[model samples]
Target: MKSRHVIFPSLMIIFGALSLYFISQFAEPRFQDASVDAKFFS
Candidate 1:
Protein backbone atom coordinates (compact mmCIF):
# COMPACT_ATOMS: atom_id res chain seq x y z
CA MET A 1 0.00 0.00 0.00
CA LYS A 2 1.08 3.62 -0.57
CA SER A 3 1.68 6.16 2.22
CA ARG A 4 -0.73 8.72 0.73
CA HIS A 5 -3.60 6.29 0.99
CA VAL A 6 -2.91 5.65 4.65
CA ILE A 7 -2.21 9.27 5.56
CA PHE A 8 -5.35 10.66 3.94
CA PRO A 9 -7.69 8.26 5.67
CA SER A 10 -5.95 8.78 8.99
CA LEU A 11 -6.24 12.52 8.70
CA MET A 12 -9.90 12.22 7.68
CA ILE A 13 -10.76 10.08 10.66
CA ILE A 14 -9.02 12.45 13.05
CA PHE A 15 -10.77 15.46 11.60
CA GLY A 16 -14.10 13.68 11.59
CA ALA A 17 -13.80 12.89 15.29
CA LEU A 18 -12.80 16.44 16.11
CA SER A 19 -15.70 17.86 14.14
CA LEU A 20 -18.11 15.50 15.84
CA TYR A 21 -16.77 16.50 19.24
CA PHE A 22 -17.19 20.18 18.51
CA ILE A 23 -20.66 19.64 17.09
CA SER A 24 -21.80 17.81 20.19
CA GLN A 25 -20.39 20.53 22.41
CA PHE A 26 -22.16 23.19 20.42
CA ALA A 27 -25.42 21.23 20.21
CA GLU A 28 -25.66 20.30 23.84
CA PRO A 29 -27.12 23.63 24.94
CA ARG A 30 -29.74 23.60 22.20
CA PHE A 31 -30.70 20.11 23.12
CA GLN A 32 -31.07 21.11 26.74
CA ASP A 33 -33.33 23.97 25.79
CA ALA A 34 -35.42 21.74 23.62
CA SER A 35 -35.88 19.33 26.42
CA VAL A 36 -36.84 22.14 28.74
CA ASP A 37 -39.40 23.39 26.28
CA ALA A 38 -40.80 19.95 25.89
CA LYS A 39 -41.18 19.64 29.61
CA PHE A 40 -42.91 23.00 29.98
CA PHE A 41 -45.15 22.64 26.93
CA SER A 42 -46.22 19.09 27.49
Candidate 2:
Protein backbone atom coordinates (compact mmCIF):
# COMPACT_ATOMS: atom_id res chain seq x y z
CA MET A 1 0.00 0.00 0.00
CA LYS A 2 1.06 3.62 -0.46
CA SER A 3 0.92 3.92 3.31
CA ARG A 4 4.34 2.29 3.29
CA HIS A 5 5.71 5.67 2.19
CA VAL A 6 5.08 6.98 5.71
CA ILE A 7 8.66 6.10 6.57
CA PHE A 8 9.80 9.56 5.57
CA PRO A 9 8.47 11.19 8.71
CA SER A 10 10.12 8.60 10.92
CA LEU A 11 13.41 9.07 9.10
CA MET A 12 13.10 12.81 9.38
CA ILE A 13 12.44 12.61 13.12
CA ILE A 14 15.41 10.34 13.68
CA PHE A 15 17.73 12.46 11.59
CA GLY A 16 16.45 15.67 13.15
CA ALA A 17 17.06 14.40 16.66
CA LEU A 18 20.54 13.24 15.74
CA SER A 19 21.27 16.55 14.08
CA LEU A 20 20.20 18.49 17.17
CA TYR A 21 22.36 16.34 19.44
CA PHE A 22 25.35 16.55 17.13
CA ILE A 23 24.99 20.31 16.84
CA SER A 24 24.80 20.75 20.61
CA GLN A 25 27.81 18.51 21.09
CA PHE A 26 29.92 20.84 18.97
CA ALA A 27 28.36 24.11 20.12
CA GLU A 28 30.70 26.53 21.88
CA PRO A 29 29.49 28.19 25.03
CA ARG A 30 29.61 31.96 24.85
CA PHE A 31 30.65 33.90 27.91
CA GLN A 32 28.60 36.85 29.07
CA ASP A 33 31.88 38.67 29.83
CA ALA A 34 35.21 38.01 28.10
CA SER A 35 37.09 39.40 31.10
CA VAL A 36 36.09 36.49 33.34
CA ASP A 37 39.22 34.84 34.70
CA ALA A 38 37.30 31.67 35.66
CA LYS A 39 37.50 30.60 32.06
CA PHE A 40 41.26 30.40 32.21
CA PHE A 41 41.25 28.60 35.59
CA SER A 42 38.90 25.93 34.25
Candidate 3:
Protein backbone atom coordinates (compact mmCIF):
# COMPACT_ATOMS: atom_id res chain seq x y z
CA MET A 1 0.00 0.00 0.00
CA LYS A 2 2.81 2.40 0.83
CA SER A 3 4.53 1.74 -2.50
CA ARG A 4 1.35 2.62 -4.38
CA HIS A 5 1.51 6.19 -3.15
CA VAL A 6 5.05 6.73 -4.43
CA ILE A 7 4.45 5.03 -7.76
CA PHE A 8 1.39 7.09 -8.67
CA PRO A 9 3.06 10.48 -8.18
CA SER A 10 6.17 9.38 -10.04
CA LEU A 11 4.08 8.31 -12.99
CA MET A 12 2.22 11.63 -13.01
CA ILE A 13 5.45 13.64 -13.01
CA ILE A 14 6.86 11.64 -15.88
CA PHE A 15 3.69 12.03 -17.92
CA GLY A 16 3.57 15.79 -17.31
CA ALA A 17 7.14 16.25 -18.47
CA LEU A 18 6.46 14.30 -21.64
CA SER A 19 3.32 16.32 -22.36
CA LEU A 20 5.18 19.64 -22.08
CA TYR A 21 7.93 18.45 -24.37
CA PHE A 22 5.45 17.50 -27.07
CA ILE A 23 3.52 20.76 -26.72
CA SER A 24 6.67 22.79 -27.21
CA GLN A 25 7.47 20.85 -30.37
CA PHE A 26 3.98 21.36 -31.80
CA ALA A 27 3.91 25.10 -30.95
CA GLU A 28 6.81 26.03 -33.23
CA PRO A 29 6.36 29.22 -35.23
CA ARG A 30 5.70 28.69 -38.92
CA PHE A 31 4.25 31.98 -40.07
CA GLN A 32 4.55 35.77 -39.80
CA ASP A 33 1.08 36.32 -38.35
CA ALA A 34 1.63 37.36 -34.76
CA SER A 35 -2.02 37.02 -33.86
CA VAL A 36 -2.54 33.61 -35.38
CA ASP A 37 -0.10 30.77 -35.18
CA ALA A 38 0.80 27.66 -33.27
CA LYS A 39 1.72 28.68 -29.75
CA PHE A 40 2.14 27.17 -26.35
CA PHE A 41 -0.24 29.78 -24.96
CA SER A 42 -2.53 31.90 -27.09
Which candidate wins on TM-score? 3
lDDT of 2 at 3: 61
How far residue 31's Cα lies from its native spot in candidate 2, in Å, is: 6.9
Model 1, runs deviating above 4 Å: 34-42
Q: Is candidate 2 or candidate 3 better by TM-score?
A: 3
Over 1-42, each residue of candidate 2 has an lDDT whose tens digit, in order, gives 566678887889999999999866654453334546337635
Poorly placed runs, candidate 2 (over 4 Å): 29-42
Candidates' lDDT values, in order? 0.82, 0.67, 0.76
Q: How many residue pairs clash in each candidate at the backbone level?
A: 0, 0, 0
Q: Model 1, 1-42: lDDT tens per residue?
A: 699999999999999999999977787677677887546644
> How accurate locally is residue 21 in candidate 1, as Cα lDDT from 0 to 100?
96
Query: How should the candidates be ordered by TM-score, best one leading?
Result: 3, 1, 2
Relative to the true structure, candidate 1 reaches a TM of 0.67
Q: Order of all candidates by lDDT, from best down to worst?
A: 1, 3, 2
